[model samples]
Target: MEPPEIRFQILYYLYNKYYGGQTGKLHSAEKIIQETELKNIDRNLINGDIAYLYSSDLVTGKRSIGNGGYPPSIIITNKGIDLVENIINEIIVNILNQQDNRIVKNKIELIAKSDQRTRITKIWGYVKEKPELFVNIGEKALKLFLSGGY
Candidate 1:
């Protein structure tokens, strides 16, 4: 299996490719194989990478039927979309140094590196005082955070 970073890369790739994680869009395994940076990676490894993303709830797809098989379709979940958008937003914040965007890009980088559970825990701790931050954590948690929906 590839490293956790590879899973993230695959997740980000699918998010961008599939209209920023719009639900219900499905693509063949071949398209993913031929188009992404992971193209050169062994098919089995890519399968594993996708599996990792699936387990993390960053993607939704069928499991490969047998050992070392590729899943038939791939779709980035809303959670995955939120992750990528959050990172992008954080970068924009860093570049503009705007007063409203309180988070620095470095924190976003760290959040990107961490798993979903860990990211939520850290963010929760950081903003525990602000009860509004908890509103979207149920359905579109990360999205609310990035959009300042709270």
Candidate 2:
């Protein structure tokens, strides 16, 4: 069976991108949802994810006055980063062991040919419009993945 998706992944990605190694940085839920490209993630799911993260001592949220009027901004802790790293490592190892190199290559090609390409293209447009926000997020994510023991 496929392992459940860890919400910490999205949290860590945000933390790493915006917090610059700090434990807590105020980020609105709407911003997080948009930045993470969490397609169709509802309010209930977001609330549940935040609750789980908070319970695990991975993230903390606070009320903030922003464009969204009362959005809670969340910050990630060191524990969250560690959790995300572990999950990513596990995924990389599993992928490396279970799939042949050719299969992996083909899958990447297929992804490039299919929906991911369009999605990435759209993200690129946003990035171009707001270069400062997405500056190193993609590069950092790629670097992290490549440095793993895949």
Candidate 3:
């Protein structure tokens, strides 16, 4: 199975392409490749990603490959939204797992660099003692990170 994070990214991209704007929103395969900041990615690989999500019933799209075919256009399904939510929940669960996850550590480092109260040593010990605080911080950190503030 593709990892949940990768799946979430693909679903998020399609979801945003279909619904992120106030005006008309649609993206072709070429558009997805051209517009996304995802680096070193190949068109064929992304097409395969589309196929995988489509097969999982998480997205709706038509993928055509060959000489005289239209480009792929995809939209997220309701199931995709649910799966994305579940994936985010899983991310929180994983962070709350208290293992040494690199992403959470990195995010904590970012926080430490941003504010003294959120310094890694302080927040780490506090969060270890109080899981609830970690959840609140995690939610905020996740939002900030995804919003490109980190």
The prediction achieving the highest lDDT against the true structure is 1
lDDT of 3 by residue, 1-150 (tens): 223323445665665554445123445656665665444565555666666667767776565766133336667777766654443444444555554768666664454454322242344454547566465554543443332232
Query: lDDT per residue, candidate 2, 73-142, as tens digits?
Result: 6776677655555544443334334455575535434434444324333333443464454345434443
Best by TM-score: 2
Q: For candidate 2, give the lDDT.
A: 0.50
Q: Which model is ahead, 2 or 3, in terms of lDDT?
A: 3
| Ranked candidates, highest lDDT first | 1, 3, 2
lDDT of 1 by residue, 1-150 (tens): 234435545665676666644447777667876776667778776777666556667777776667343357878888877876565444333333532344544554565467644554454344344435333332243333323242
**Cα error, candidate 3, residue 76 (Å):** 0.4
Q: Candidate 1: lDDT of 143? A: 35
| Sequence-dependent TM-score of model 3 | 0.52
RMSD each, Å: 12.3, 11.7, 11.3
lDDT for each candidate structure: 0.56, 0.50, 0.52
Off by more than 4 A, model 3: 1-6, 17-19, 22-25, 63-71, 99-150
Worst 10 residues of 1 by lDDT: 133-142
Q: Each model's TM-score?
A: 0.50, 0.54, 0.52
